[model samples]
Target: MIRRDLLLTLFGIGAGQAILLAVMPFLARAYGPAAFGSYAVIVAVAGIVATIAALRFDLALSGAEDASIVPLSRAGLLLPLLTVPFAIAVLALALRLPFGAHLPFRSDDLSLIGLIALFQGWVLLGSALSTRRGLFATLAAAKIVQPLVFAFTALLLLHDLSLAMAVGWAAAMAATLPAWRHLPSSMGWAETRATMRRLWRFPAISAPMALLDVLALSLPLLVFAGAYGERTAGNYAQVQRLIGAPLVLVATAGGQTFLKHAGDRLRAGVSVLPLIRRFVMVMLALAAVVTVAVALVGQPALTFVVGPGWRTDTGFLLLALLPVLCRVIASPVSHILVLTQRLATQGLWQISYFLATAGVLAIAPRLFGLEGTLGALACSEFLLYGAYLVLAVRAARAANPLPALSSKTRPLSASS
Candidate 1:
C-alpha cells in the first residue's frame, strides 16, 4: 500500500516537474540571461525566506500524529504572518535607503519578493498537512496544476519570466485551498495554541536540521552565482531543476511513505531493520538507473527542450552531480531520524555538511572558477553520503537489535 502510494505520488510529481524542466530552458532563452538572473535571485531570496517562515513545520508535521492540526496550522500561519508585516516594513525602509536609489527595479519588486516568500510558506505548510493526512494524490495533483498554471499564464498574460513565476506560484497556492478543506474542522484557537507549545519544544533542534538540509541543497546555486555570476547560476539552475524532478519525485515520495509506515512500525515495536535494508538497496539501484539514463540522454533532452544557444555546460554540471543519486537513495534514513525524534543528531549532521560544503565552495571558487565550484559541490555530496550511510546503519541496528545480522540485513558499509 505504501509503495503504491509512493509510485502514484511520484508519477504525478515527476510528470509536472518534467514539464517544468522542459519549459525552463525555453523560458531562459526567451527571457535572456539578465531576466533569467533576476528570476534566479527572486527564487533564491523567496526560497530562503520561505524556509525561515515555515519554521521547519513541514518536517515536524511528518512526525506529528497528534490531533491538534489547529495549533500546527496556527503556528505555521503565525511565523509567516509575522514576516509579512516585517517584510513590508523592511521594503518600505529599503526604499528610503540611498542604496535603493541605485537599483534598476522599483520598490515594488520587493513587495513581489515578499509575496513569493509568503506563498512559498503557505505551500510548505499546506504540503505538510497534506502529507500527514496521506493525501498524496491530492498533493500530487496540486503539484501538476501549479506548473501548468504558471507555464500557460506566464506565456500568455505576462511574457515576463519573473512575473510569470510570481503569478504561477500565487495561482498554484490558490488552487491548493481545496485540499485544505479535507482536514478536520476540529482545528480551533485552543488546539492551535497548545500545538504551538508542543511544537516549540522541538524546533530548536529540528529547525536547524531543516535549515541545513535546505542549505545543503540550495547553497550550491549561491556559490555559483557569487563565483561565476548570475548567468552561470541561471544555467546551472536549469539543469538542477531538470535533474531534481526525478530525484525529488521518487526519493521524496518514497521517504514520506516510508516515514508514515516506519513511524507506526517503530511505535508498535516492529523490527524495521529488514525494511530499512531493503529500502536502501532499492534506492541505490534506482539511483544507478537514473544516473545512467540522465548521462545518456541529458544533452539531447536539454537541446530538445530549451532550443539552441542554451548552455550545454548545464548538462555537464548535471552529469557531475550524478553521485547525488546515492544521497537521494539514502533519504529515507534521514527521514527515519526525524520519525525517531533524533532531530538534534540529524540537524548536527546536516549542519556539519552545510559548513563543510560552504567552506569548500568558498575556497575552491578562488582557485578554479565555475568548474572548481561544481567540483567542490560534488565532493561535498560524497562526504554527506558517507555520513548518511553511517547514520542509517546505526539507526537500523538500533531499531532492531535481534535482526542485526540476519541474512536479509544488508550492512551499511556493504551497501556503500
Candidate 2:
C-alpha cells in the first residue's frame, strides 16, 4: 500500500512535468529568453512570498492534533493576509527601482505578484491540509492542475506570455481548496492569536529560513545574468528546469509520504531512525546511478532535443549532481525539524547556506568561472545536507523518547 501510494504520487508529479515539457517548445517560440527570464524572476519571488504567507504551518499539519489543525492553519494565513497591503507597497516600490529592472517588472507585474502570492499561499496550505487528512488524491490532482492550466493559458495568450504565465499560475492555484474549507471558520481574534503564538517558531524562524533559501536560489539568476549575460542566465535556468524535473518527480512523493508516515510514528513515540537510514541509503545509491548515467548521455540528449547551442551549457546537470542527491535524501527527512519544533537549528542552517552560496558566487567566479562556481555552491550544500541529516536523526529520536502515545481522540467538529 505504501509503495503504491508513493508510485501514484510520483505519477502525478511526472504527468505534470510531462505536460510542461511538451509545451516548452511552444512557449519558447512565443517568448524570447528575456521574457522567460522575467517569468522566472516573478515565479521565484512568488515562491518566496508563498513561504512567508503560509508561514511553514503546513509542516505541522501531519503531526498536529485534529483540533489544532484548523485553528493553526487559519492563524498562519492571518499574518500574510494582514500584510498583503504592505507587500503591494513593496512590490510597487520594487518596480521603480533599478534592481527591479533585472527582474523585469512592468507596471502590471506587481498585480501579478500580488495575485500569485495570495493564490499560492492558500494553495500551499490547502495541500498541507489534504496531506494531513490523508487525502492523497487531492495532492495528486493539484500536481496535475498547475501545469495543465499553465500550458493552456500559455498557448492562448502567446502575445502576452508573461502575463499568461502569472494568470495561469493563479488560476491553477485558486483551484485548490483553502486550509479552512469545511471548518466553521469562526475563531475569534483571541483564539486565533493564541493559536499563532502556539506555533510561533514556524512563522518566526522557518518562514525567514524559507525566504533566505529562495533568495539563495533566485538571486543567483540576477547575479549570473549581470556578470555574464542573458544567455548564460537563461541557459542556467534551463539546465535547472531540466534537472529539476526528475528531481521533483522523486522529491515530491518522498517528502509527502515521509512527513506523513514518519510524523505518525514520531507522534506515537516510535523510532523512524531505521527508516531514515535505509531511505538515505537508497537515495544515495540512486543518485550515484543517475549521476553516472547523466554524465554519459546528457550532452547527446541536449543536442538532439534542444539542438547544438544547448550542449555547452548543460554542464550544470553534472555539476549539480551532488547537491541534487543531497536534496532528495535530506528533504524527505527534514520534516523532523517540524516534528521536533527545532526551527532555530534549521534557521541557522539556512543562514549558513545563504552565506556560503553567496560567498561561492562572489569568489569562485574569479578563479574558475561560472561552471566552477556552481560546483562550489553545490559542494557547500552537500556538506550542509550532511549536517542536516545528522541533526534530523538526533532531533527525531530526542523528540520521541517518551512513553508511547495511544490513539488520539477524534477531533471535534468545526463548531467546537
Candidate 3:
C-alpha cells in the first residue's frame, strides 16, 4: 500500500512537472529572457516568503500521527494565516525599496508575487494537513491540478506569460482549500495550541537553515543580476528553470512519500538505515540517467523551446550537477533526521553546506567566470551530499545500534 501510494504520488507529480517543463521554454521564448528572469526572481522571493510564512509547520506534519490531524491542521492554518499579513507588509516594503523597484517589471508584479506567496503558504499548510491525515490521494490530486491549470492557462493566454504563470498557480492552489475542507476534523483550540507548541520548536532551528539554504541556491542569480545585468540573469534563470524541472518533480514527490513512510517506520521502531540506503541508491540511478539524457538532448531541446538566441552552455554544468540532483532526490534523509529528533545535527549540516558554498561562490566568479559558478555549485553539492551522508549514517546507526558496526549484519527487521 505504501509503495502504491509512493508510485501514484510520483506519477501525479511527474505528469504535472512534465507539463511545466514543456511549457516553460515556450513561455520564456514568448516573454524574452529578461521577463523570464524577472519571473524567476519573483518566484524566488515568493518561495522565501512562503517558507517564512509556513514557519516549518509542514516539517512538523511529516512525523505527526493520524490522531493529531485536527490539531496539526489548526496550527498549520494559523501560522501561515498569521504570517501572511506580515509577509505582505514586508513585500510591500521590498517593493518600495530601491533594489526591488529596480526590477524589470511593473507594480502588479509585486502584487502577483505576494499572491503567489500567499497561495504557497496555504498549499504548504494544506499538504501538511493532508499528509498527517494520510490523504495521499487528495494530496496527489491537488499537486496534479496545479500544473495542469498552469500549463493550460499559460498556453491559452500566451501573450502575457508572467501573468499566465501567476494566474495558473493561484487558481490551482485555490482549489486546495475545498480539498482540505473535505479532510476529517479531529481537534479543537486546546489541542491546536498543544500541537502548535510542539511544532514551534522546529522553526527556531529550521528558520536559519531554511534561510541559509535559500540564500545558497538563490545567490547565484542575485550575483548574476548584479554583475551581468537582467538580460544575463534572465538567460541563466531560463536554463535553471529547465534543469530544475526534473529535479523538483523527483525531489518533492519522492521526498514527500519518503517522509511519511520513513516517519511511520521510525515510529513503529523499525530501523531506518535500509530505507535511507534504498532512497540514496534510487536517487543516484535516476540522477545518472537524467543527467546523461539531458547532456545529449538539452541543447536541442532548449533551442527548440526557447528559440536559438538563448545561449547557455550549461550542459556540462548540468551534468556536473547530477550529484546535487541526486542529493535533492534523497532529501528525505534530512526529514528523517528531523523525524528522529536530531534537528541540531540536521541544522548543523545545512548551515555548514551553506557557509561552504558561500565561500566557494565568493572565489568562483574570479576563476572560471560563468563556468566557475557551475563548478562552485558542483563543489557545494559534493560538500552537502558528503555531510548529509555522514550524518544520515550516524543517525541510522544511533537509532538502530546493531547495523552500524557489523559487516555481515542483515538488514534491520521492518517493524510497521
Please tell me which predicted candidate would have the highest lDDT against the true structure.
2
Candidate 3: where is the Cα deviation over 4 Å? 91-108, 175-187, 312-323, 400-416
Clashing pairs in 1: 70-192, 71-192
The count of residue-pair clashes in candidate 3 stands at: 0
> Model 1: residues >4 Å from true position, as ranges?
21-25, 84-109, 182-187, 313-315, 318-320, 399-416
Worst 10 residues of 2 by lDDT: 403-412
The digit string of per-residue lDDT tens for model 2 on 1-416 reads: 56666777778788888887787766665665656666766666666677677677766566676667767667656656855556678778877787867544466766677767777776777777777777677777777888888778778754665466666656655555643467775766676576666666667777789888777867667677767766666666666666655675577577777777777776676888876776677677767777777788876665444444443333677874556677787877877666655667777878988888788888988998877887887888789888888888877766643321112322212221
Give the candidate order by descending TM-score. 2, 3, 1
Write candidate 1's Cα lDDT for 118-228 as tens digits.
887887777777777777777787678778777777666888666677777777677557657855665477766656665663456666566666766767666666556
Ranking by lDDT: 2, 3, 1
How high is the lDDT of residue 303 in model 3?
73
What range of 10 consecutive residues in model 3 has the weakest lDDT sum?
A: 401-410
Model 2 TM-score is: 0.87
Better of 2 and 3 by lDDT: 2
Q: What do the candidate models score in CA lDDT, each in turn?
A: 0.68, 0.69, 0.68
lDDT of 3 by residue, 1-416 (tens): 66787787787777777787777666666678776677677777677777767777666777755545566666667776677678667767776888875544356666766777777777877776666556677677777788777677766755655566567667656656654675557547886777666555567877678777777777777677766777787777766666665576667666777777777776667887888888778777887787787788877776777786676554544734554574675575656666656667777777887787787767787887877677667767876777787777777767732211122323323220
**Candidate 1 weakest ten by summed lDDT:** 401-410
**Model 1: number of clashes?**
2
| Candidate 2 residue pairs that clash | none
Could you give me the TM-score of model 1 versus the true structure?
A: 0.85
